[model samples]
Target: MPGFYYPIYFFQLDAIKHGVSVTFSFYSLVILNASNFVGRVTSGYIAVFVGVINLTIVATISCSVLNFGMIGLNSLVSVVVLGVFYGYLSGVYAALVAPLITTLTPDLSELGARMGITAFFVGGIGVLIGAPISGALLTSKYIWWIPAVFSGTISLTGGMVYIIMRSMFIRHQFKSQA
Candidate 1:
């Protein structure tokens, strides 16, 4: 989530360097935000049927793949397309994260504390390091792909962690029932 923000923040510069028009560059940002809005609204309603954790895992994985696709794209159209896809998927993942956390916590009374602690750790670390790492990659020139790869890998890893946690939770539930 925060990982994706780094590239988006630098998108204007990137688009200009790639010979994309100023109008389209700004449109790229607008398209991303608009699609993100749609994704957030739709995902919330969809989560009721599909489950928040499952939806989040799918969205994260999709965002990861889209981020990877961003690396090989040099055309304005390609970048815009990928940006819209990434925005939508990322929005879904972001919207569901809080609800997923709430579902995972065992005690309703401790939900706020759990959410606060989780947010502090994930947001604190991600916000602190994500931009710096992306900046470093951009400065390297030869290693520009590193930022996309790194962001995608992080998103993929997060999804895997969620999958594992979900499996463990299911196992525990079954054991208690048995």
Candidate 2:
């Protein structure tokens, strides 16, 4: 998410910077965003059938894998690959947002709104910064590969966080049963 967002965002920004026409820029942004719509929605819905908490690990790993794939992309074909991968992953990611809140919080009533807030904050603040910052990384003598590094880092970080949290939850559950 954060990783893909950064590179795509930079791609968008770069296109605009070069006066690539609004249609071109908009289409690029649209393609980039389509990944989330597909990934987040589909995965999120599936999270509903399985335990949301359980799927958290799945979503996290998907994020990491997709992000790494995203990092390796060097052309339009890669973008399409990213869109497919990210879209599916994003679906899971979005689904887990609410489920995660429901599992952790006592009040299930506020789950939707609370999770929405969390998503907004995470997407807006965390991911929003990814592109521009990576773009900054690109400023230094055409170091295009820098974006891949940053995106890869973001994916790995998100995956680690999911793994740690899922493990803790599992341990807690096992202990309670014992």
Candidate 3:
């Protein structure tokens, strides 16, 4: 989630760096938010058929690709396009993470505690660490690609983690059956 949101947090800065005015940058966010709403609502239903983990992995990876695409973006139109796509993918991730957590927990009684712990790491620690690191990468020079790469790499790493978790779950199920 932190990885998913890093681009959103710094979007204005990215826009300014790429020669977009502050006023237009705001519209990009509005567009993003609108599309995000659609993605969140639709992904919930899609997850029922496609599976939460599978969709999440796809969304996360797609978001990483979009972030990487940010490296060379220089126009408002392109940025707006990127925002629309990123917003949707990030929204998918946001909607599915809770269900993914539920699947990981064997004891339903521990769900709340597990969610709290996960939230602490994702919401608390990740936010704390991610922003600063991305900011530092940008620094006074405002080299956009540096932070774009950072965010993309983080998102990609997150997707890989889900893939590993899914594989582990499948392995566990097979072992138990055997």
Number of the top lDDT candidate: 3
Q: Estimate candidate 2's alpha-carbon lDDT, on a 0 to 1 scale.
A: 0.65
lDDT (CA) for every model shown? Answer: 0.77, 0.65, 0.84
Index of the highest-TM-score prediction: 3
Reference-based lDDT, residue 130, model 1:
77
Query: Could you give the candidate ranking by lDDT, starting with the highest?
Result: 3, 1, 2
Clashes of each: 0, 13, 0
Which rank order by TM-score, best down to worst? 3, 1, 2
Model 2 agreement with the true structure over 1-178: per-residue lDDT tens digits: 5674654456555554444565655666677677767666566557668778767767666666765564455555555566556666655666666667778765687877777777777656777777677778778565656766777778778778767887887888789799
Q: Kindly state the number of residue pairs that clash in model 1.
A: 0
Worst 10 residues of 2 by lDDT: 11-20
lDDT of 1 by residue, 46-133 (tens): 9999988889889977887876776776778886787788778878877887898888888899988888878667667876887787
RMSD of each: 1.7, 4.2, 1.5
Error of 2 at 64 (Å): 3.0
* Candidate 2 error regions (>4 Å): 1-4, 11-28, 106-125
lDDT of 3 by residue, 57-137 (tens): 899899989889888778988888988998888888888878888988888999998888896665678777887888888
**Comparison by lDDT, 1 against 3, better one:** 3
